[model samples]
Target: MNKKTVKSFRPISWPTKGASAKTGKWRTMRPVIDKEKCIACRICYIYCPEATITPEIEIDYEYCKGCGVCAHECPKKAISMENEVH
Candidate 1:
């Protein structure tokens, strides 16, 4: 009779939750922006590491993680992280 055993596998650098560090800080989903506050200054668009914010266009929620970075960066503070009205 013959028998075989399967070997267990594990990743060297396991990418778990919030694995990527943002400037020595860990981060997960991030925010886009609210065009109402955006005055074409392009501040958020310039500082965005992920290049998620749109230029002269409303936020593209498809890529936005809603981290509130853009809201904090806004010069006018026009952006805010508001939860669903419901």
Candidate 2:
């Protein structure tokens, strides 16, 4: 297998200004965590393409887009998507 032929896994159309301008920065979105539902499986941390999830059992809101990938892949269904109040 040629290394040059390997397909890349990267995010597309990520706005440089981020979700909005209200935050005055490149903000992604909010990622909500339910401690009751979370089993500490760390799937969010494992599957986050943005590297937004952390091993500290928390989701990095600054990087998370509320994409629901964590919730979709979550075996425990611990994550949820919500609009930020910003």
Best by TM-score: 2
Off by over 4 Å in 1: 1-37, 84-86
lDDT of 2 by residue, 1-86 (tens): 65555567733333563443333124344567899988888888898877667887776665565666777898887777666665
> Candidate 1, after superposition: displacement of residue 53 in Å?
1.2
Runs of candidate 2 exceeding 4 Å displacement: 1-29
Q: State candidate 2's TM-score.
A: 0.61
**Which ten-residue region of model 2 has the weakest summed lDDT?**
17-26
- Give the Cα error of residue 85 in candidate 2, in Å: 1.8
